[model samples]
Target: MSVAAPPPSETTIADSAQNPSMNDLVTEQLVSSGDAASFAPRTALALLHYDVASTILTDLTPNELLNFALTCRSICNVVIPRYIWAHIALTPKHPRLQVITLLRKIAFSVECGPHFIRHLEVASIHVKKPYLKCRNPWYLPYLFQELFTQMQNLRSLSIIHCDKMLPHLPRIPKAIVSLPHLRSLHLANFSYLALNLLDKLSGLQTISLASPTYNVHEFLSSTTSALQKILVNSRHTLEEIRLFEVCLNVDLIPSHHGSRADADTNQELCWPHVHTLELPQCIGDGWAPALHIAFPSVRTFASPEQSHWWTAALRDASFLTGLESLHTKSSVARGFTMAGYTTRRLVIGDDMPFDVTNTPLKDLLPRHLVNLQVSLWSSYFDPTLERFTTVLPMVTPHLKYFFMRMNRGFICNTYHNQLCDIVDDIRTLPLEYLCITWDVNCGKKRCDRCVRRSCPEPVAKYVERRLPSLQALTIRVDENRRWHWKKKKVEEDGVPAGTLSLMSPTREGDILREEYAKRIV
Candidate 1:
């Protein structure tokens, strides 16, 4: 006798109801009966077992069950082109609701779904339809309206790339409009002349508009709504009232907002309540004046090509007051370290033009800086030893973690001493983590002068000194060797080439730990 498999959840009733052989019979019966959900659960479970045993599998895996449910309908209209639309043998009416229920259950689980929700969950469901890669161009509008209406708990709604017609006269369902959970609303690529649902959301906190043809006054006048933040991605017109939008003028021409052209002929623009701002590469010198004013209470700011932007933005007493963290694409932190400014953190990398040589450690650092991560590829690698020396005097007081890479550029040279000085100065501070990497691509003889040979000594000394506050020291070294028998035998023949002597010092982890134990003890 054979054993029977248990049934799937109620959400996937069809999967539990019909077999491939019985699809025609089931559909025929469902068509005749006029209702699929009203079918007996026992009948459904029997069909599912028959199909599982006869065709699909002897036993279903977790992925198979979830995929089966997803195909039944969670993300709809996601039909693959030029491929077969394989049916699940059971066709039920309102399959979408069942899929939604299954997804909701999965979302409530302790592990993955809940984790994704916690990270992605926000006050609203901001769907950038315009950014969505069109799966099927034919049913775009209908599919969008269906998905938008289904999100019953959505609060702040941001739907980008919605056609103007949809935005101009959004035909939102009565159920969606009445959702007490609904709050702020943002629309882009939606060219609606008027939105009737604007005032319905009484708990709106932020409203952002990013349409090519935006009428600021028209949007504001349309609703007598109260909001804490408003962002308009357009130079349509500026009201003397508070506004939040960072502008980048590629041609160095300030926006023409019709009010007082002659009031301040100096063209010194200023933003008031913007707490976070991003100045792209296109912005120029005219931005300096704006930075002095808008950055009073700014907490996080980023600028890619504009090194001067950081200098100008930080010089303001007000800008440095409430500042907590700063991010730049380029290494503007090369010459400077964040030691003096009140900001606590710094992130500099590829997105910005990181030129640390120009922005010395003194000018870049704020007073209370606690954590900083400079990009590994920044020019600082070659000149890091010197830069570290200059930065140590100021950063050592508050620096907690110094992360770096020991690649080709970082060799046993003058920079080695600078690293020692930095470690010595930071020994007294609560520096807890030091993550360093060394690339040992070639055998010791092939690239004997590689940087790895130089690092162990300093690392040994630092470890022997015993950084009491340090908790974890992770070092990843890549040993790469290219066969150079020709060079090894003929080139250095007189020097007794082809010898199997180890050029790079390899220290055992146990030895390092023992050394550490002695120093700490």
Candidate 2:
């Protein structure tokens, strides 16, 4: 069985109690160069590079630093010089500082070095200069142009505020076309890029665009050949997007100030090949027809907003066609209504009801779904059980893996009951993996359902009825169960028993929720 990759370790902020000096923190982080070799190639290079920078930037002024480090001429000569032979003469006073200056100089001089001088790769000035003035209008385009020039091999790129900068730049298509190795590109402000730039990134495998001004029709008109994944979050109407082989992220930003009628009409954006759809923070009703037509092949879908749009979208759409999964703000009520899709995977939010206006699970669901993911945010017990009950039978006949995350009270009020139901639901199929995750707020009203409960009788019943196909089961609970010594009685028994059972728990809240849905298939 293929297991999901575990999440990264938690970052603990250092306090005076932990360390006295910045140097002490540095010492705490000091990895022997030998241990550093085990890091990912990129990570190792970045760490060593930054370590060098930490030593060099200690004494330089901002402008002097710019002139010495990032300015184009400085980058070409002192940073990444064209001739290593000319570098021997220009040495700084400090030991490692002199070494960094030398390496940058040698890197610039190598043949084909400019093409390889990516931002994250070398000491490309594009990433360095931005901190000086990120919001200044001129800084945006200047940095982007430099980034475009420097990181020719960039696989992923993100511009957070494209709207403020895209309209101001002249359209230059060729520069984007020249980038060859780019695989993923995210433009939080796509409006800053010309339609030509979109046309040029034909080699991209994944793309996310967020723009309120640009017309999506422009993108549709460009090229559909090389693109595999696309995301559009635009207020403007978009048309003719052909995405049969891609995973797409499409979001609509709702405006309370804009023309209400126009806002209402703008929600019907289409995506033809998308398998994953996420609509968060959008305002509109047009999503129904838009999704119905655009993503006829979609298998995974989600929306953070609760509206009739979801119900309408699922009704006329082909539920049995190419879909395999569905995710939304409310899990039980909304999911039960659209159960006709026969999706292999289902992700439901806790706060939402399992009951909706139209459709029921037996009527809507296909009996072949294999995975069930339940998100917890609601604290009530019975309601959460109802949500689980709704999807259980609909999913049981084909389900294999059940993932229950009960860090927050909002998901299932009875964590033990939810686990019991999940085991019971998998009776008809091979229940292979059961993952129970917990968060930090355990013992509180919001987290009681996940912690206060014990492994109840139903849990053992399922164990006896044991689905043999169930080979892997992971139970993850939060590590941060703490008590205020001053406020509460301290006892050895009062300390939680299963703290040692906690490996690294998943941070369900921080997860890009859409990432969970799209992979449902």
lDDT tens readout by residue for model 2, 1-521: 11111111322111101112223222222232233333343232222332353344344443343233222221221222212111123334455544344333322233224332324342111111112232355544554454346544455444444444344544323554566665554555344244334543454445454444544445545644122222233112222222221212232322221224553344333334445555444445343444444445555555545465555545544533555665545443344445544567766654333332242445433466677776544444454344644566554566666666654543335455555654565466655555555452344565434443443334433543545454334444454431111111233445442121112233332242224333443
lDDT for 37 (candidate 1): 65
Model 1 Cα lDDT, one tens digit per residue, 168-211: 32445344456566545565543333233333333433344443
Off by over 4 Å in 2: 1-130, 134-148, 162-174, 177-183, 189-204, 210-275, 290-293, 303-306, 310-315, 318-320, 329-340, 350-366, 376-395, 407-429, 439-468, 478-521
Candidate 1 Cα lDDT to native: 0.40
Structural similarity to truth (TM-score) of each candidate: 0.44, 0.48
Best by TM-score: 2
Q: Summing lDDT over every window of 10 consecutive residues in candidate 2, give the lowest-scoring window.
A: 12-21
Give the Cα lDDT of each candidate.
Answer: 0.40, 0.40
